[model samples]
Target: MNTFRAARFALRAKPTASFLGRRTYADAAGPSDKIRLSLTMPHQAIFKGTDVVQVNIPAETGDMGVLANHVPSVEQLRPGLVEIIEEAGSTRQYFVSGGFAVVQPNSQLSVNAVEAYTLDEFSIEAARAQLAESQKIASGQGSEADIAEAKIEVEVLESLIAALK
Candidate 1:
């Protein structure tokens, strides 16, 4: 049997056994329940299989909060802030360029982004200068591709600036 089929069979055979090798029952979720979050970039793994209380993501559809037992869905992320509420009641925010967020059936959220940085890591002056340059290039007589790229940069910079505020 294929690996996927075998896994499916195993899951069916054991309703309480999740794909993450954890056992979960169909019980009413509570605030104490934790969701495993995996936030990854190309070169870094921000939160790898870490349990958290909640996560607020900036999806293309809209901003949504994910908690344990959230309905399974995939969301395309936009350039904005991702707020993670840790188990200890502390919140951390990161600015992600763009990516996808997947809420799995097993109380897990996986976020893959092109780029991500903490709010403190950004320099307002530098971002403002870059935004100005990108705006100029987007309005200038550059190639269509260059103009399009600059426009995307402008969008990201604007979002980053807003997040920094």
Candidate 2:
């Protein structure tokens, strides 16, 4: 059985070079390349120079996808989900409050958000309750500043609900 297992492992192994069991820099930026992504929030860095196949972000202009060698540009993000496609064909999604996404030269992407978390981290019941409260405050005869803050809260909660779907 041990010999059979060793043979199976040998058959599954490839000749590609790896570093610490991770893909090498050359592999990440090879001819069939991936973009290096840096997704940062105020309190945490979700992705720190990680290589990915594509990234879909909700920008104020519109929803956009960034791929390797994409044009360098800056986009103001809206409160929504950011999807990251990795080299292994797995995808990660994060809900960001709002911020900026900058596609730098040499296939580098940087996203700085006010807050971010995975969709599973959110409680839909809590969001719905808050949304209802925000709506009430935004529509009521509250102070201008209070109404404005409530409106913003409503917008963010609505977006989060939409993303959860």
For this target, which candidate reaches the highest lDDT against the unseen true structure?
1
Quantify how close model 1 is to the true structure by its C-alpha RMSD in Å.
8.8
| Candidate 2 deviant stretches above 4 angstroms | 1-32
Show the lowest summed lDDT stretch of 10 residues, model 1: 11-20
The lDDT for every candidate, in the order shown, is 0.82, 0.81
lDDT of 1 by residue, 32-68 (tens): 3788899999999999999997788998977877767
For each candidate, what TM-score against the reference? 0.80, 0.80
Instruction: Give the total clashing residue pairs for model 1.
Output: 0
In candidate 2, the residue pairs with backbone N, CA or C atoms under 3 Å apart (3 or more residues apart, or in different chains) clash, namely: none
Candidate 2, residues 67-153: lDDT per residue as tens digits?
A: 665556788999999999899999999999999999875778899998999999999999999999999999999999999999999
Q: Which stretches of candidate 1 lie over 4 Å from their true place?
A: 1-32
